[model samples]
Target: MTASHELRLITLYAICARLFFITLIVSASLLPPFDSSHKTILPAADPRSLFDVFVGSLLRWDEFYFADASRNGYQYEHEWAFFPGPSWARRLVRSVWSTGGRRTISSLSEALFTGALTNCLTVWSARILYLISVECTGSASVARISALLSLLPSSPAVIFHVGYTEPLFNLCSYMGMLNCMNAKWAQASFYFMLANSFRSNGVLLAGFFLWGLIADPFLRKQKIPLLNCLKSILYAAITIAPFVYHQFTAWVTFCQDDGLSVEWCKRFPPLIYSHVQATYWNVGFLRYWTPSQIPNFLICSPPLLLLFWSSTDVISRLFRSHTQSGLAKQASMVLPHMVPHAIHAFVLTSWILVAAHTQIILRLASSMPFLYWSAARLILEQPKLGAWWVGWSVTWGCISSILWAVFLPPA
Candidate 1:
């Protein structure tokens, strides 16, 4: 009906769905964790009461580091793997919450605070994603469908987890993308800067600045003004400044005097993020291609395939002379504005497939609106596959939530 009504509906749906997911996830704690050691993963994971299931159990996986960062500043070298943005948000919220700052997030008050913060971020992120989808597709119906699909994201566990980056990162990324679609370059840059502070790959968001300012104009053979060129340079620099500064901070921490003992410090440029990833997480080109990891790859295929196909669909439309009906018609209506996002999806999908942790695409892909939009396209034009995708999202989302609560694999 009306925009306000639509927003109200979205907010209500998000809240209901999130609560439902949280209910199932927390209830799953009745089952013992996959590993006995999970009891010690977080002090809160000790089966004391329902509060532990609801809040404490969420502090699994990378969240341990985040809880540490929020409670205590980055204390270890590997802690740099997590950007401080989400932790900073947690700190700000916890501070204003005016309680539970005495120790680690094991306290019930702190755990509740974490859930509230992440839930708010996620619900609002869905709202912003709807706005961005409408801007991109030029149809509220498409936007509505996409936003609903976003609610069934591939990793509800991680997205809803306490102290996880997905919630904050998705919100900032969508806000920035929405601003970009509205031609608000400054707003977009500021949000992009925030997104970069949460995830290192957020540097890739500079594509929007580059495409809007330089690449898109060049592709269309439109004359770019000198002022525009200067603005593009400035905006791009601003967008990537967080990532660059993150690297700089790492250098200062580990390189200046820590070099003699650290192998990564001696390397030219000395980026500790890369070193930490490769050394600690075994992240590199083809490194995860072993037999033991095939299941992980299988686990991550749907989003990666969606990203790959959707990105190619957009690029192919750019080259095709006409659009076909039904599925092709729905997919081939390429808005020039969407090109940069498609390119981003393609590049990121490629990177994750070969180099980064493939399984992360579940949660990582959530930050990209393109995935949801693509899923919407399938629902409209290719119902069978879309149904499968929806099934996968819901089934996997519930399972992963329990897996996360129990400190299971696919971390």
Candidate 2:
């Protein structure tokens, strides 16, 4: 790397390190006392809390399982209801603690490990954004801008501190993308599958991987033979099989218990329309509520609205350029690669719309690392102004996130 590139990497790493420390502090503050109330600090109970509950229940599975069943039926176990595949991993984690009467230490250690995993993932996601920006723009400065923007306080606060799957899912998504770019189909498929296991929408990475494969220039020179194609297909299937099996099991269980169809549409109706209306209402102008909630609303709305506008502008520009560029040209280039990202944004938006839940924002924030790079590349032809705009936006976003973290209620 050149001197400038090294400098950019160092600067971005420093910013990420700062954000990581901040996230750790915030997350530590939010940890519940060992014997305090069962209620969580955050507005909605998320995977983190559920993970904690699962660990606690492992100490007395029979009693806790039946009690939870009596109280909330299957709903109480919904979060831990991973399919047969992850059950072994869960058991292994439990086994580590069951060896000694160190349950408390085990629980705390689990929480800390999860938090650290999330922090590392967010940092890796930022690094991927930096790499993509450097590739697209061929400028160390632009890459640094993308990396710094991704490390802005909002993204880290949401991912590391908020106790969501966003960080892990984002890391896996980017790993899949990176492996695909390097033509490592098997590794790409594995990370993509892991991402899917983390979150339902993570299958989007497969679309990204396919786009990367089709767009690769090497494929033109060395024609994809039948064996290669078969290998790729097998890799993709192996990556997807676990998630499919998990879904199938869930569907069977739902049908057996509820006596109803278990189609994806029935399970999640809004998936059909891309959940556009719901996405808009939840994260857009409609997010503002009554005066009592205005402070919280104001704190959350700016980054969300900015992200919405940025995504909209991207879509609008694509549509406007379609006729001039031609569908085939665009499809083989940036457009198709970007489609998976757009789908990710849409899915995240839909979740926000339906749930109006706070943690969802952090989940969607994972996509911003990629989106920010795209935004920088799109506008950076104007160099000076583009740099200023990106810098200012990042500065404001960081300030907003810090203030929000300082003042906002726990979780």
Candidate 3:
């Protein structure tokens, strides 16, 4: 809060941001060269392998199906069955890029570009998270610490450098959170929608915004008029429209292909479905048997534990101060707003646990920014304890990173 403190925080943020960028550049340089021979026509029936399947789906879009009938002269199927609209857009982009006679960038270049974009988004998201904490708690220290923790060089940074979707999702989610806190409902809805499109987990933004609106003292005092609320809801609906369109297209394609209604459950084999069902039934099951999967489980467990512990502390604090000062009254007034955001976080976390395959570690890493912010706040309240806690977290994070790199499978 002091001038000196503000200066120190700003300095810390700048240094961290610079270091993050440097780390990204160095890591990208260490990656293997992109295989030029890997390039081929869109949708090669059985497409060389899984990596090809993913690249073709991402870059060519028209190759997202299993049939070859739709392919005009291409060896692979042009079945634009699932999410056809996006495929058309992708095709257009590729056509234009080709016509320009620009050499196709290698896969390594593509990966690096994506990684750079993701890291930039991560920085932006960290700033937004910092802003939200400042707005909600009115503590500059909280904001600074939250931003720093969000950028920790662990799973999040690693995922960003690998062309994963987590960084982009984090950016949109945090932007939505910031907009919601500021009572910019339309903007919040737009960002939330973008986040959801990238990953279904982004629907959590809707819940977070709703809570912020209801809890905000200004909004509660008629800052958000009925007309504004209606407009916000409409904006949210518009944003969600694309997802609806995608699902509809997918369904129509499926129906046309099968000549009958498609059953979602029947799509997956019975054995795999049964395994997933069992996992869902057992919340704390340690039944992962694969050597590769064990590390993932270990990496994911610490964050869940931290989330649980922080939630308990928050609840306890809320109750302990319930009968005291005007702060209590303010908190009581705000509790309703907090409820929805809390619930949304819980739902998103649970969904990650249940729906995720072995990749749950990476999937849930996006939520670490928010969770770490919460944990940081709890620790900040107790100076000595906070210092100890942060020290341990940093130490463990470093150890984990080294162990992960050492055990990583050879490329």
lDDT of model 3 at position 385: 60
Report the C-alpha lDDT of model 2 over 1-411, residue by residue, as the tens digit.
784565557556845664655544444434443332223222233436645433331122122332233233445224333223223333445566567765633334544444455556666677676665565445677667667656654443433433345565666777776676567888888887877765555555555544445433232344655666566567667666666765554455554654354333364531311233233334334353445655554555544654566556555555655556643354212443454455456556555644554434643555545456544554555567556545655554555344333333323
In Å, residue 241's CA in model 1 sits off its true spot by: 1.8
- Cα lDDT listed for each candidate: 0.80, 0.51, 0.49
Residue-wise lDDT of candidate 3 within 95-158, one digit each (tens)?
5545867875444345345445555666566666767767655667766776676655334234
Query: Residue-wise lDDT of candidate 1 within 289-378, one digit each (tens)?
Result: 999988988998899888899899888786562334322243444677677889999998899889988888887889998999889989
TM-scores of the models, in the given order?
Answer: 0.92, 0.60, 0.64
How far is 262's C-alpha from truth in model 1 (Å)?
A: 1.9
User: What's the C-alpha lDDT at position 99 in model 2?
Assistant: 75
Report lDDT (Cα) of residue 34, candidate 1: 70
Candidate rank order under lDDT: 1, 2, 3
RMSD of 1: 3.4
RMSD of each: 3.4, 8.6, 8.3
Flag regions of model 3 displaced more than 4 Å.
1-101, 153-156, 213-232, 257-262, 265-298, 312-340, 353-362, 382-411
